[model samples]
Target: GGLVHYVTWPGSSRLLVSDPAALKHILLTNQRNFPRPRQQMSLLRKVVGANSLLATEGDTHRAARQRLNPHFRFANVSLVFPIFVETAHRLVDRWSKLIDADAAGGGAAIIDVHPELSHFTLDVIGLSGFGYDFDALASAGNPVTDAVNSLLTPLSLFVLLRSAIPALNALPLASLRKEKEARATVRGTVAKIVRKRMEQASEPVEK
Candidate 1:
């Protein structure tokens, strides 16, 4: 218990780990001994696909990581470096516009940077990962952005109760219905992007 301690919740207890060596042992050296909690996996799979690396375990996770490793290599990552720079400039311009509008109204602008940063992150991921432009910084009403935001909404008491009692998840609550729709929107959008890429790959290249 040198760097680990137990913490109890309403219905369960879990270890709070802090030691770096112990963490490495649990996460990398002997990962098989520990598995992600079912509740955590279920929540992640709802957003990221069942087969995604984050939702899978053991050999499946390893294989998924290997498949994605090439895309994270130095050369491949550098290919998307321009996207990062361009997105950053867009963020700056957006902030500048806000500041200018505030000044025009004769008041100092107090900006909430969290949502802006979130938009920047989404923009980068959409462009670099999927070759899709979320344009989250330019506008807030994009369907893809709306879907992603819905998934990020803060958990309510109903959601907490559902997690504690899995049976409640089957109830016909409006929040649950909205969450299901959001999941569908995210899944469908990603599938369309993937299908387009597959079709492009199958096309004959000009000599």
Candidate 2:
């Protein structure tokens, strides 16, 4: 119905229009012409991967989506149901222990469930998607979990600075330094896993 202009950075205008026709035209018809901002894509690539769908465009984006769509289908997802249930049970067991520990220490102890849930979700992703047990909920200070947390942490002020002045990313801030370290850790861990998988695959099948 109306156009809204937001000044995300100095001397720049980001538009948000409430017109359905305009939205449809931009999102559906002219999407290729209006790709994600280069800075946003570059930042996302560092977190996800160089070949990540979030950072890809045009034919590469289409090909990646097409390849991933089958594995993400409801039917395919159903195949991981057992893994999901097992993870869920593991989460419950961990929580039960926490509650028991609290009860033994005091009558009623306040607990923060956010980190527990975060670890549970990460464990689920590791087991189901990568066939690696992160065991984040079962153990504290898991390197993979710590790496992911460091990389994906939301820095509100840093985000605004990065978005407004893309060059700020080059500055060696504490958050940026931590992110670099986390990325290295993730790369090393994934490389090790990939090498192991390759070695296993090359082994002769047990007859």
Best by lDDT: 1
lDDT per prediction? 0.84, 0.81
Over 1-207, each residue of candidate 1 has an lDDT whose tens digit, in order, gives: 546556555556677787888899998889999998776777778778888887999999888889999989999999889999999999999999999999999999998897778889989988998898878889857877777888876666666666668899888888788888888987898889899989998999999
RMSD of 2: 4.5
lDDT of 2 by residue, 1-207 (tens): 468888864578899878998988776678798887876787788877889777798889888989999999999899789988998899888778878988998867566777767788888777787788988888778888899877666657667568668788799788778888899988888788778878988999988
Which regions of candidate 2 are displaced past 4 Å? 1-40, 73-75, 103-114, 163-166
Candidate achieving the largest TM-score: 1
Error of 2 at 37 (Å): 5.1
Error of 1 at 17 (Å): 5.6
Error of 2 at 127 (Å): 1.6
